[model samples]
Target: MVKKKIQVLFEDEHYIAATKPSDLLVHPFKARSQDRRSLLRSLKKQTDLYLFPIHRLDKPVSGVVLFAKSKEATRLMKEQWNSENVSKHYIAMVKGVTETEGVYDFPIKTDKGLQEAKTSFKTLTSNDEYSLVDIEIFTGRQHQIRKHFSRRMHNLVGDTKYGHSSINNIFRKDYKFYRIFLHSYQLRFIHPFTKEEVIISSPVTEDCIHIANDLFQFDLTNIGNEAKEN
Candidate 1:
């Protein structure tokens, strides 16, 4: 079987960002000859440069993933991510009709104990079964978005770990959806080297687009444009 090339979103001397497909790891657990499915590995082969992973999206989720071209670049970018200088946005399909806009400032359980996490969302559209939401996350805790929404019973569609089984079944059968309905659509930060603001957006994946349109009667082609305008 032939592997599909990962789509590059933004690239420069310091950083390279790409749209990560669902089921691909950002980094490998261990280096080996057969472990060829990771995004980091593929990007390295594609660009012939040693890439440093800047952030992560779970293997089951799809969207923007960034890498720094050098260690110095990595440190500077990580500083922005660790502080309030970064903005991350996502789009998700949840099991229930959500409010027009709201913030989930609940703390998430981590290895260090409960850490502060804030996830704010706006309902883009909805139906009797589910809703499409635009989300902004303030903290980069692991599984923060999934946990926050699931805690409120607004579980993301197709999220087996923290989702509604009945709704997952419905989408699996009716909409042919099989992956978690969460996407990191936009990322904005100050370029640590260039000293200019940079905004990068990844378009919704085809699988998510198909299910979203089928379930919500929405078109996802303008997703990137929407992120840029906002």
Candidate 2:
């Protein structure tokens, strides 16, 4: 198979931020024995440098992912992440309309047990059938956004794990949309080396825009720019 190009959004002496395509793993896993192609490995081949993953996106979710260039940079970035100093923002197209703004302050179950997870969301636009939401995650528990939104009965579009199978099938058949409708739109943090504030963002994929327009008549032309500013 031909390799998909990893889209680099930002790069510097200490860090790199890149857009990860859906269905791609951030790192190789023993559990996923057959799936060895990962973003880290691909980046290593491309840059020919050892890279450290600072954060991860779900295999089926596409968007910005951060990596550190060195062990020290990784340590510093991980410290910021653990302290909740890193700001993560995402855009999700969901099954139903939501309030103008709301927060899902709930605990999610993990292998270690239940952990506190908080996600805030603002409705950007909506029709009767679907809503485009801007989400800010306060906690990084696994599948936090997907689980929280599923609890609210607004499972993300094309999310088979937490969403309606029929809806996913419909999109797949009609629009050829197969990936979850969640994009890691923005990441903001203080640079570990420069000690300066940095913000990085990724544009919504063209497929997502086409699906939104075709299915809901929603325009996402300025969403990326607006998301970066806010």
lDDT scores of the candidates, listed in order: 0.87, 0.85
- With a 3 Å backbone cut-off (N, CA, C), the pairs that clash in candidate 2 are none
Q: Model 2's lDDT to the true fold?
A: 0.85
Looking at model 1, the pairs that clash are none
Q: What residue runs in model 2 are displaced by over 4 Å at the alpha carbon?
A: 82-84, 225-230
Residue-level lDDT of model 1, residues 1-230, one tens digit each, is 88789888888899999989888888885566355579999999988989999989988889989999999999998877956788999999998889999999989997678999999999999999799999999889989999999999899988999987888898788877788999999998888977788888998888888877877789876786544322
Assess candidate 2 and give its TM-score to the true structure. Answer: 0.93
Among these predicted structures, which one has the highest lDDT?
1
